[model samples]
Target: MATFCQFAFFIAFGSLVSVHADMKLDCQQDFVSLVWTETRPQVDTSQYRLGNCFPTSVTATQAIFKVELNACKFRKLVTGDLLQYSNNLTYVSSELELLPFSLPVTCVYQRPKDWYPMIYNPVFDTYGQGELLFHIGIMNNDFTGPAESSSFPLGSLIPIMASVQQASHQPLQLFIEECVAATTPQLSPNGDKYTIITNKGCLVDSKVSRSRFIPRQKSSEILGFLQAFRFSTGEQVYVHCTLVAWDPVGLDKTKKACNYVQGHGWELVDNPSYNSLCDCCESSCNARKIRSTPLGNEMVHEVVLGPIMISEFSDSLF
Candidate 1:
C-alpha cells in the first residue's frame, strides 16, 4: 500500500494571484511517487520537476513523477538506527519573468527491534559436522520474517541474514566469501549464475545495484540486502553462498565486508577505521593460510536459500 501525502503549495515569489497547486506524494517502502496538480493559473507541465528528474507522465493539469528510493540524487542520512532519504520538487513557470517554487520531500525507514534467527525455520539450518550450526534465510523489509521460501518484487531489496550457532565453540566472525543466484535449488558449476558477492566479502553487485551489507550486530552473524533480480523471466531464484567462520578480532584484507562507493571506491562496512583492509577489493584478495586453532581453521559451509519468486507486485514473506 502507498502512503499518500498532501502538501499545500506556498508562493515563494511573484504575486499570489490565487494560484493553487495540490501536490500528492505517495511514499512507499521502496519508492516514491508524486503528482502535481495545477487548477488555477495555466502553466506548462514540462516546467515541473523533482530534483532534476522530469515527470514520467504529464498532462495539461497534472504531472506525475516516479522514482526508486535509492535513485534520483536523493540525499541519504543514517541517524541512529533510522535511515533517511530526502529530495525536493520544484515548479518553474516557462514565462520569461517568473520564479521557481520548490517543495521538500523525505522518506524514513526505521529498523525493527529484536529480530533474529529464532523466528527462522529450522529446516534451513545446516550443521557443520556438529562443530558449527549455520543458518541462511530471507527476511522482510524491516528484517523480521520466517526463514522460508519467499517472493519479492523485481528491483526491490531482499533482506537476507546468515548466522552461526557457536554452542561451546570459541568466539568467531562470519564472512560470506561468495554468493550466487540460480534458477535451481542446487547450484551447479556450469549453470547460469548471477554473482551477488565475490572477492571474499566484496559486494560486487552493489557496484551496479543497491545490494549492500548491513552493519554487524553480533560476531557470529552477518546480515545484508540483495536487490531483487532474475536470471530468467518469472523463474524462481535460489541463492547459494559460501560462509566462513574466522576469529572475531582477526580481520584482514581477505576477510571483510566491503562495499563499493561511486567516488570513494571500496569501504569496510564492519569497521571504517579498518578501511585499509578493503583496499584489495578492486583487485584480487590474496588467500591466507588457515590457523591451527578452532576459530582459526575457519569452519566453512555452503548454504542455499530460496525458490523465491520475483514478481511485478510487491509482497513480503513474513
Candidate 2:
C-alpha cells in the first residue's frame, strides 16, 4: 500500500486548511488497485484511468480502480534477479485550466534461482482429500484475481472459478450441478432462495438474467459468470454450489454446462455434440436410474461463497 498526494492550501470555515487529491495504490499478491480521492468539486472522475482500466467505483469524492495485475496492460521489466510490473495512473480533466497529472506505479518481485511460473493464491476454500484437491473462488472479470468483496450491487457480473488440483495425472472434468443464493449461509426450506444453476448444470438464471457459463480453459476447471442479485433488499447473499469432478471422456446429461442462449435456446458450452442432453434443461433432468459410485479421481464437493451484501448503490464494474 502506498499513498501519493498533491496538496493545495485553502481556507475553510475561516481557518487555513491544507487539501490534497490523494492517490492510493495497493499491489496485492493477486491484483493491483488504485484509488483517487479528490476534494475538488470541479473534477470529473470519468476522465481518470489506471492503465486501460477505469475506476470500478466512483463517487463525488472518491474513485476506485481495481484490476487483475496480469489483465491490465502493465509493462514488465526484468533486472538481474528482480521482476517488475509497472503502470501509470493518470487524471486528465476536460477543463483547459485544469492541468493533467500522471503517477507512476510499480510492483516488484524477487525471482528465485529455480523459480517457475505460478499463479498467485487468494482467499480460497479448499477440500483436500486423498489424491484430489477441490477448490473454489470468486474471481475478477478476467478470471485472474481470486477476488473477495463485502458488497455487490444488483446486475453486477460476478466471475467464479472452481478447480481441482490433482496429484494423479488423470484428465478430469469439473461441473456445477446446481447453485442457489440465499440471505443466509445455510440453506433452509423456508428461507428466501434464488436458484441460478439447476436441472443438472443448467444455468436457469440465464433465462431471466445475463448469467452464463464462460469458456473452459481446461477440463479440470470450470468458470461461470453470475449476475449479482438479491433475495431481500440490503441483505447478505450467500451462494452454495454443488461441484463435481468427473471423467472428461464420460460427459453425460448430468455432467455438463448448459447456458440458455437468447435466440438459440439452450447450448452446451463444453461439448456441443451433446446438445440433446441440454434439451432436458427446459424440462427436467433426471438422475441416472442406477446411480453408481464416482471414479477414483472423481468426487462431489459442496462449496459456499459469500456473505456478499447486495446493494443498489454499488456501481457496475463490468
Candidate 3:
C-alpha cells in the first residue's frame, strides 16, 4: 500500500513540473511576438496650411515592451495572425505606457479664401485733390483683431503712397504724396459705424469758388454757418482743418511733379487766411457737426492729430 502511494505521488509531481515549463515558454514567446502593425500615424490636414502636414502612424519599440509586461501580469496567451498580432500588441503597449510619440506626416490641401491680400483706397470729395489718401493694411484673423488704427508722420506719406501705388499697379497720385494728418474712425456704440472726420481746410467746389471764398470775415457769420449745419448727438466727427496754413504749398512742393511743373495750373495753394475768412464770413463755420449713433447710447471718440513727420507714413497706414 505504501509503495502504491509513492508511485501516485511521483506521477503528480512530474505533471506539475511540466506545466511550469510550458507556462514559462508561453510567456517568453508572447513577449517576443509583440510588434507595431502600423508604420506611422495618420495626420489631420484640415487645421493646418502652408503645406503643413502631420503624421498618421508610428512604429515604436517601447510599445512592444508594454505589451510583454502586461501579458506577464495576466498570464494571457497572445493570439491573432502575424499582422493582427502585431497591431494588437502595439495597441496593448500604447494603452499601458500612455506614451505620446507621434510622427508628423504631410499632404496637400486646398487653400482657403480670405487668405490673400485685400487692397482698397478711400478718397474724400471734401478734399479738392481728386484723391485724398487712406490706406488699408494686410490683416489676418490670428495676428490682429477686427478693428485697428495707426498714425504716421507726414514725411513718410510719400514712400507709403509709392508702395501702395506699386502694389496696386497704379501710378502714385500726387495728392497721396503730400503730408496730411489723419485720424482713424472710432467704433460706434453698437459696433456698426466707424466715423473719422479729417480737417480738410475750407474746400471750394471748382464751380462755386467765388461764392465760398469771399474775403470779408466775421465771427457771427462763422457761428451762423456752423449752427446751420445740424449734427446728431453721439456722431463721430473728425475735423482735419489746417492750423498753420490753409492750402499747404509746402506739401505740394514736396512732390516731384509739382516741383518740375513750376507753374502747373492746379491751384495747389488756397488763401492762407481761409480759416479766419470762413469764421468771419460764414456763421458757425467752426462749430462741431453732430452725428447720429447706431448704438442706442454707446458712443466713443478716438481722435488723433499731429505735426507728424512725412517719413513715418508707411508704418502708420498699416
Candidate 4:
C-alpha cells in the first residue's frame, strides 16, 4: 500500500520497514555512503529460474525493480550462444516475493546487454519529518544445467541436488540503515542536534554561501553571538534575523530593517563574525568535537556558540 504523505504526495516502502533513524539524512542534500549490503558467493539459483528475461530498460531509479542475473551468473559466457546463455539464465521468481523495496541494488549491469558493473547510488527525496528508514537486499539466482552432470567438483552434495533442478537453495539476509537527519531538530538517540553548516557542510562553513540550493540561515554578530543571549521562559524558539536584501558586491545578506523583524528584534555590531556555532536557537549551543579523517581534518577556526538553552532552567538562572 502507498503511504499518503503531506501535500498529497505518496511514498511507498516496498519493504514494510521504517527508515533507519541513525544515519544522517540531510534535507535537499546528497551524501556519499553505502548504508547497506548483502552478498552470497555460494547459492543454488535454480529455484528462481522462471527461464524468462525482460526488455533490459530497467534501472535502479525505476519505481518497480527486479533482479536480472543473466549478466553475472556465468563466469564465462560465449557471445551469441543462446543455449549457453539461456542455460545460465537466472531471474527473480517466487524467491523475490519476500523482498522489501524491490530488492535495493548497489551494483547492476549498466545495460541489459552490457556486462560491466555500475555503481548504484540512489537519491531519495522526501519532505517527511523525522527518522528515515530504508530497506534493501540482494540475491543470487544462477540456474544453469543439470546438478548430477556438473563438471565442477561437489561430490558431497551431488546426490541431494539430483532432483532439485532450478530452485534457489540459499538463505537470504537483509540489512537496514537509518538516518535521523530529518528528525525534529535532527536529534540523535544520545541527544545531539545535527545542523548543516553550509558549503563547508557540518565540518566547515564559508564567509558566504556559494549556492542557494542547500539553503541555511545567515546570521550576524549584530544578532548577539559574542555575548550572553537570552530567550523566553519555556519555548524552543527557532530564530533568524530578517534580511531585507543583499549587498550588491558579494550578495552578502544584510538585515537593515530592525523594525521589520516583527518582535524578533535585530542587532548591529562593529565586529561581525560569521559563526554558525554561536547561532543556536536557545541560550547556549553544543560544543562541537572535531576528529580528523585520512582525507582531511575538520576545517574550522572556532566553535561558534549560539542562543542555545544550557539547561531546562536556563532562563531562570540567567
Candidate 5:
C-alpha cells in the first residue's frame, strides 16, 4: 500500500511540472492584446503578436503612458492584439489670436557706396506749458522687414514723439534743430503729390514751433501735396526733404488717407530723379547719385522733416 501511494504521488508531481512548462511555453508564443486608455474614458483595443521568448510582464518607461498586453485568448483577432500603446500625451496650450495691420513705412538712405534702411518712429516733445514739437526719427538701422503702417498712431504723433524722446539715450533738448537743408517736391501720376523740402527754409526762425497739421486744418494744401508723389508698393523711392516738406504731417494722417493714397496708385520709384537738391549735378557728386537696383523693391514710403535753413547755405549750414 505504501509503494502504491508513493508511485501515485510521483506521477502527480510530474503532471504538475508538465502543466507548468506548457503554460510558460504558451505564454511566450501567444499574441498579446494591447489596450489604450485616455482621461476621456475612451479605450482602444489592438492585438500584437509577441516573440516566442517574450517575458510574461514588463513596466512602461513613461508614467503618463502605459502599455499592457492581453493574453487571455488564443484566437486571431480581427483588429489584432493590443500591442504596446500610450495615451498620456500632453496637450498644448492655445495661443491668442491677433488682428493684422498694414505694413510700416520703410525708409532707405543710399549713398554712392552703401545703403541703410530704417523704420520711421514719430516722436513728440513739450517744451513748456502747451508748446509741442513733433519729432520723428529712424531710431535704428533695423531693416528686418517692412514695418506696419499702423504701428504709429495717426492722432498720437505728439505722443509718439514723446515716447521716442523718453527712449533716447541722450537727454533730449526741447530745442533741437533739423538736419537736412534742402528738399524737392514731386508729383505722382495718380495725382497724389509729395515733396522733399529741406529744413533750410525752416531754420530761419530761432524757435520754430513744430506741430502736425491735420488735413482738416489745411485740406486742399495737404491733398495737393499728396497728389504730387507716385507711390509704388514694391519699388524703392528716395524720401527726400521735398516729400517731407510737402506733407510734414504724413505721420499724422489717418489710415484712410494712407490707404486712399496708396489705392490711388502710388508706386515705388524706379529711376527717381535725384536732381531735387542739385547736389548730384556736380561732377564729384555724380558718385553720390541714387541708383535703382533689383533690391529697390524693398523700398518703402516714409516722410521725414528737419529744421529750417537757407537754401543757398544748405551745404555749409546743414
Candidate 6:
C-alpha cells in the first residue's frame, strides 16, 4: 500500500475537507476518476457524461451513484455537479444511494497528456456550490465532419425520447441529474398514458418494450418514449441529433454551461443571451434561426439532406 499523507483543504465558505482515506489530493496526474462495479447501487451511467466522455469506463472516472432505502423503497440519483473547480484538488459531490452498504468510491489518478490550465475559484462563493451541469455520451461529438441536421417549417411536431437508465441493462423512467427527489410517472395498466408527465412537451407514444407491470429490464435505450414537440410557435427550426442531461432542479434553466473560474472553483456559467445561444448539448448542432425571411413563401416539399435536425424526425424515428 502507498503510504498516505493527511491534509486539510479549507473552503472559502468556512469549511474544511480532510482527504478521504482512499482519496489523495494530487495535481500532476493526467486523469483522475472515482468508480466501482457494484450494480444495484448505481444508476444509468451510459447516458451519464461530464466534459466530453462517460467516466465509469476505462477512459473516464465519472459515475452516477444511486441508493435504495429500505424504509420507503425508492430509487434516487444525483444530477448537477461541478466535477472540478479552480484547482486540482477541488471536487463537488451530490447525494447518492447504495443500500445495505455505502457507495464504494475508488479514485484513480493519472498524468495528463495535454489539457487546459485548471484553477479553483468561484464567482459567487456564497452559494457554497456552483452552477448545475448536464452531460451525455462522448461518442456523440468525438468525430468531425458535417453530421446531418434537419430543418422544419412552422407548425411541425418533432419526435423526442428520453432514456433515464439505471445501469447498462436496466430500463426505467427515473432520470437523475441531481438527486433531490424525483417522482415516478403515473401510468395506465399498460404504461400507455402518463398521468404525471415525466418529460413535458412530448405526448404519449406507443411503448417499445414490455408492458407496465414489467418495464424492459432497465436498459439504456429508451427511458420515456414520446412523439414530437415544437420549441417555438413561429419561425422555422433547424436542429441536429443531440443528447441532453435535463436537470429538473435549476434556478435558471438558461445557465447550464459549465466553466472553470480561478483556482479549485469551477463555476456554472451562462451562455450570452445573444448571437448563438447554447443550451444543454441536446441538439449537437442546435443552431438558432436568426432574423431571416421564410424560404421564399413557396412551400418546398424536398427534404434537404444536411444535418440531423429535429424537423427531420418530425415524422418517424427508430
| C-alpha RMSD for every candidate | 18.2, 16.9, 33.6, 26.2, 32.7, 19.9
What is the C-alpha lDDT profile of model 5 across 1-318, one tens digit per residue?
011100000011112112311111101111222221222111111111122122233223111211132332111101011111111111121322311111111111112222112321212111111212233432211222222331221111211121112221111112111222223333245543232222321221112222221221111112111111122322222233211211111211111111111222221111112113222211121222222322131211233432111111112211
lDDT of 2 by residue, 1-318 (tens): 122221211111111111457666666665777777887788888787777787899998888988886776775433334445666666667676655655556666654455432432211112222467788788877676777675767788878889987553234568999999987889999987999999989999998888998766555778888887657658778899998876443467887899998898999986565689899997889887423432332577888988777778556554
- Candidate 1 versus the native: TM-score? 0.56
Q: After superposition, how far is residue 9 of candidate 1 from its true place, in Å?
A: 51
- Write down the worst ten-residue block by lDDT for model 6: 297-306
TM-score of 4: 0.14
Per-residue lDDT for 30-59 in model 4, tens only? 111212211322222232221232322322
- Model 1 residue runs over 4 Å out of place are 1-130, 147-149, 294-298, 313-318
After superposing all C-alphas onto the true structure, candidate 5 shows an RMSD in angstroms of 32.7
How far residue 184's Cα lies from its native spot in candidate 6, in Å, is 40
CA-lDDT, candidates in order:
0.70, 0.69, 0.20, 0.19, 0.19, 0.24
Q: What is the lDDT of residue 158 in candidate 5?
A: 18
Quote the positional error of residue 314 for candidate 1 in Å.
Answer: 10
Q: Tell me the lDDT of model 5 at 254.
A: 11
Of candidates 4 and 3, the better by lDDT:
3
**What value does the lDDT take at residue 223 in candidate 1?**
81
Lowest lDDT block of 10, candidate 4: 155-164
The deviation in Å at residue 203 for candidate 5 is: 11
TM-scores for every candidate against the unseen true structure: 0.56, 0.56, 0.14, 0.14, 0.15, 0.19
Candidate 6 residue spans exceeding 4 A from truth: 1-35, 38-318
For candidate 3, give the lDDT of residue 247. Answer: 17
Q: After aligning candidate 1 to the native by TM-score, how far in Å is the CA of 78 from where it should be?
A: 35
